[model samples]
Target: MSDGWEDSADAWVASQGEEGDFGRRWVMDAPMLERVRRRPYVRALDVGCGEGRFCRMLAGEGIAAVGIDPTVALIDHARRLDPGGDYRVEAAEAIGFDGGAFDLVISYLSLIDIPDVATAIREMTRVLAPGGTLLIANLAGYNSAADAHGLGWVTLADGRRVHAMDDYLEERTAWIEWRGIRIRNWHRPLGAYMTPLLEQGLTLTHFAEPPAHGGDPARQALYNRAPWFLLMEWQKPRAGSSSGPTGRA
Candidate 1:
């Protein structure tokens, strides 16, 4: 059980050529950059950073950023792409860094790939400096739940398209295959993602379910009916504070 990513690393990197996949280009990257640019941070870490794209983006913005991933091939590719970047072979469950080392930590679409979600979340929180932020972009619970059971949108007799969802409460691993790539992704309920941060005393600062990209109308229409991704911003409380306010977008 190698998570199926070691073999797919080349295809994955190629699929995200130059910019990124469609979702990353239209939905994830811009919003993520906007959020990170709004504040100043000395150091940033990208946990489970596939190919180190986001880390490179941060470095281009003058932020000292490092990327870590468990997959050797992907880490090697990242290092080759940005020779000066600090990319390491590390796992999300036990990041090799001191506590309070990073003012910003990002897990962009990596949580789904991590099997030990709780431990990974705790480790991410541990490395974050007090008052720091943790930004995560992941497959939404709805999409995961639906895909787990092999359910997708189906047309009704009355010309309505609806997606059927099932087993959302069950936490398990599911296989996804597409265009010469295969990977195992964990499907956990929404609470499975939020509760760990809450338990660690992190505050939910922002949440977004952005609409699909504009250029492809048909694809946009399908996504408008059901969001494919979820973005969340959680912040560690400042010294002497128990919690912070939550924001939604």
Candidate 2:
């Protein structure tokens, strides 16, 4: 959990002011919020909640949410920005909560940052109540794979630029440097994520590669070809629950 994130905390906070970076502002915000509103949750937990942005969003709507992150500096920012909010410095892999304590658990753009995604998923699932939902926003596997080797967008002989992928089946790590921020991210194939979730007995209730909105038209068109993000709602079935699994949206 401690992979030198404290160094990048300041730059990250500055980068994600109020609206967030390009991805959150345009591609993810609307869709993620819309899906969160579909169900009511008495208690919610946001794992890997850097600066607690989404937790604050839920709080604005009168929903109480607890935000957790391992990085001390980021947690400080969260507490400083929203003094009355609940923000804890805790790792996703070792969340400090009882089993079935939260009705809603969210991992927003955090799977990539987490070094141990499997352990984190297990912990999140453990803390989730039956009939609860685990809402996630993440970098699509295709996008992650494409950037694995740092040789993105190769030019073809016919002058067409296409994203190139390598070592897709293997987990990869790379440092993302942007706007004075430098942080490490892990990339795993689509199956690497799905297999663990399925084994944990969670049902895929909804999935989608939603489109971007209110952004530059050219960038939006580019993302349409290969989505930069993905949304998934995984539900744990209640006892004797006859409700069946739902597919991709």
Candidate 3:
């Protein structure tokens, strides 16, 4: 069977438009761009770059970016949208690039779609140059865990909305459908993401749970009840005697 993204590529692209969906536009992009702007990276790779939106944003910031996705249709749409941009049909678990090829690598809301998170993380790290940065934006573990199990918030007698979570420690795949798009996302605990990076010797440098933007007061308050997205930055250590496989980490 085809990955659901291939079937939903056009709709997905249409939904993202020039900026991105709401969570990306309001919650994620600004902080991500800010982090990237602080450094002077010449080359960047966007893993699972749906429709190349983030790649285009990177180009706008004067960084040369190459976007890769497993879905052929999404890549075609991305290429069509940016004619001159570099977009490829590739999977994150097996990135076809030389080691230490990029000064920065970004995985924006794509880790959830990948089945083999550990392998993908390793591949992403392998292509990062010494001291290069790896930035990731993902659904918060609490939100994903609750959603995967069909759990949602409940309004208490005091009018506080509370979300009760269970099965958070388990790792599994769940299907989600929105606006004629259907896709599967993997749900894993926070440690499932952090442990592998630490094991691979990448150092976590920064983390954030940026508040929701652009929504009304009530909607914004609803989103602010819990973080919808989690942003993390990890860096390969500078070249030295203690550096690991990809020169740094």
- Model 1: weakest 10-residue lDDT segment is 240-249
lDDT of 1 by residue, 1-249 (tens): 779999999999999987888778877888898889989888999998989898999998889999999999999999999999999999999899999999999999999999899999999999999899999999888988885434467678999878977888999887888767898998899999998888888988999997766647876677778878899999988777666344211
> All candidates' lDDT scores?
0.88, 0.85, 0.88
Give stretches of model 1 more than 4 Å off: 148-151, 157-159, 244-249
Clashing pairs in 2: none
Model 3, which residues run further than 4 Å from truth?
148-151, 155-160, 241-249
Clashes of each: 0, 0, 0
Q: Report the C-alpha lDDT of model 2 over 123-240, residue by residue, as the tens digit.
A: 9989999889999999987787776444256789999988877777888888767677778888888887897787677899899998877689887877777767899999977766
Candidate 3 local lDDT, 1-249, one digit each (tens): 555998898889888889787788878999999999999999999999999999999999999999999999999998999999999999999999999999999999999999889999999999999899999999988888875433357778999878766698999888877877888888889999998887778988999998987756776776788767899999987677344554433
Q: Lowest-lDDT window of 10 residues in candidate 3?
A: 240-249
The C-alpha local distance difference test score for the whole of candidate 3 amounts to: 0.88
- Quote the lDDT for 66 in model 3: 99
Per-model TM-score, in order, reads: 0.93, 0.91, 0.92
